[model samples]
Target: MNRNPHGEIEEIEEEYNYVDAPAWTVDKVAAPQDQRSLFFTQSFPLIAVCWLILLVIMGLRIHFTSESNAKLTAENQQLEILMHLNSTLLAAHENLGRYCNNLTVQFDLLTQNCTVLESKIKDLTAVNQQLTADVQNLTTRSLQLETQRNNLTKQIQNMETNWNKLNVSRAQWSIDAYCPRENNARLCKACQEGWRLNQSTCYVVHDAVSTSGHKTWEEAREVCRRESSDFVIVHNQEEQYALNYYSWFSTLTTGYWIGLRAEGWRWKWIDGSDLTVSHWTPQLPPAADGQCVMSVQNVGWRSVSCAEKKRWICKKKALYV
Candidate 1:
């Protein structure tokens, strides 16, 4: 032990010397717990600690990435559903537009048909009114024509009555050339409506007859009414005037028979006329057998037996006027 100057003890190392040998290595395997190994023994614990921290961080990242992938798949399915719904809505709108167009065209045709029917009804009403007016006019004209026809018939009947009054003779009378009668020259035909013109006298025989098929005087008159329009009658004294120039018969001895009869001196004409005058010779109607006669001397009536043989003077008329 050695001490310093301040009285401390001092120790001393003995001098030992080691010798350098030649290099020779032994073949040996290293063990895991060898602390003195120079290649990896000191850093083994640090490497294990670092590998455990990296495992922890990698586990956390794997969990987060799995969650993100599931969320993305759900969003893609939702977008596809929305696209299908939009396409269906667009197709429905196009179908509805086509149906509305068809309905509008049908409504226009119905309106046009109604207007044509109204015009046809107006034309038919006008034609019906015109026909009614024409029918009324024709009925009024027919009534007026009937009234005029009735008035004309009355005038014609009056003229016929005046003309017939001059055709029948009552007695023998003579007139000179002053008055011209109707027919005296020619023998008249059956229905001599006009007379034969001559110098002094004008006469006509419209018809003459010797009647029979009679039972009584009254029945004979009725039968004559069916066959002739006028009964036997005489008109005036001068109507019995003889035809002088161109007579049909030529016997100057006897006068013609006029329609005259007597009942108890109550003188009557055959057509029921009053005895206004007479052309009787002296001593007429002496007895009951001398009541009727035929003209004998072309002068006047004379009494004779009713059965005497003499030609009866037939004429167009036999009734006294």
Candidate 2:
């Protein structure tokens, strides 16, 4: 069957015509009709459904991408802030290290100062100890000196008492004896019994005649020696005056032997004293060898024979009061 341009169906006649033609001549035939099925019309609804699902999936993918981008931007800002904070912390750490170093230096200096102070303290303590020891020694020495002073004071007091007593006894003796005023008061004496007090000496004038016939000069000298005395040696005018006074009072007209004698033409006393002063008579008696000196009443010294009998004066140390 064939369809025309006009919406009508037509049938073809089945006629065979034989033609006389050449050997290559053949009959012309029409192509067979297409019978393929329509695939677009049958799958239209399924394609629409698949397209809707793909649209939904694409929208969901866009939303997820936007969310991930926002999260990444926030994370970047946080990282920048952390970096700045880290830089500030590093700077603070460096400053802290410098301060720590300064503190360490100060501590070392303080330690050195403390050591010096301790050394000074030790020296001061030693000096103080030495001073204390010196003070103690001084105190001990002072005490010893004080004790010695007390003992000396006591001894001096006792000596003063004894001296006072002695002075009193001396004054009483002087009053009783009526010591001569012509002699130096300091040198006067109070003689023993039967002795006459003179200047620092005691004299014994022997008036009694000797039992061995009137004594000679040698015999008088012997008698004075037995009494622990010696013949009087008159050296001055005062002594001569005293003798004269005694002779006048005793009424002695004869001479008395003295200790003077001539030796090698020079006069000397028996006690080795030089005769510097003399009371010789204006007309000295003719001196003879072995002649001694004598003092006569109303006359000065005269040389006499050693064998002549005469009175004698003996002199000795004065007795202590």
Candidate 3:
């Protein structure tokens, strides 16, 4: 055994040397049992504190998860309500669109009807204007017709008055010129009033201005018979010459109606005398049926309708008044 200084006992020994060890090597060495037990005791409190903090964190996570779930549910419900409202609004918009379209169609139809009515009104107005013009023209024509009728009435009245005056003049002349002789006899050589002495025959000429003077061929023959006379007959060229001379004094363009007519295919006198000689104008055309002879001025003779009016000459034997 070896003892160091401070000890009383001393013993002589052999010399021995010691070397220094590294710190890492010394720490690697296992510690004593008592030191290990004391180290565990100190670390126990730190481990307990870490466990408490972990538990607190887990509790906070659970609380936050519950709140997030509740908020998500509420948001989902709200979103569903919004989707339903959008659907309802879309349906209403569609209905309004249809209603507006119907209104547009109705308005278009009304516009067309109004246009047709306007066209009809214009046509009616034009027709009314034409009718008014036609009425005016008819009124003017009626007035013209009325004026013509009045003028014709006045002419008829004037002709009737002239005829009445001529008849009165003839009556006065007959009353003033004829006179009866003694023994109710008149001179045979002297002609009656209004007669001219012509080779033992009394001849009278009807005035053209008198109403009873102008007569058709048939009417002239009847008038001569009423006066106890007959139409002038020309037995020879001398008598025709005398008759032609007498026609020169007439105031008529158409001289007189002779009692000569176309009968059976030849000209004949009304007294059944044969017409052997004719005083026709040069190149006289053939006569037609119902045609009578008329002495025309400067033209000898012409065939005319029996209805034509002309002056005539009558001859009779001289009679006393």
lDDT of 2 by residue, 1-321 (tens): 122433222112211222333435344222111111233454456677677777777888777777877777777777778877888888888888898888889889999999998998898899889889989988998898899899889988988897898678766665555455455464444675678877777888887654344478889999999877899877777777766655532223357788888777667789888687777776655445688887776777777788778777888877675
Residue 26's lDDT in candidate 3: 45
Q: Per-candidate RMSD vs. true structure?
A: 24.2, 22.5, 16.6
Task: For model 3, give the 10-residue run with minimal summed lDDT.
Answer: 10-19
Cα lDDT tens digits for candidate 1, 78-151: 76776777677677767777777777777777778777877877887787787778778777777776777777
Better of 1 and 2 by lDDT: 2
Whole-structure CA lDDT of model 2: 0.70
Clashing pairs in 3: none
For model 3, what is the alpha-carbon lDDT of residue 48?
Answer: 69
1-321, model 3: which lDDT tens digit per residue? 222353222111111111233556544333433454674576567766667777777787777777887888888888888888888888988988998999999889989988988998898899899889988988898898889889888988987898789779765544444443547753333567778876767778775776466888888889889887888777787768657766654433466777688887677887798777788775454656688877755568777788888888888876444
Model 1 misplaced stretches (Cα beyond 4 Å): 1-78, 121-321
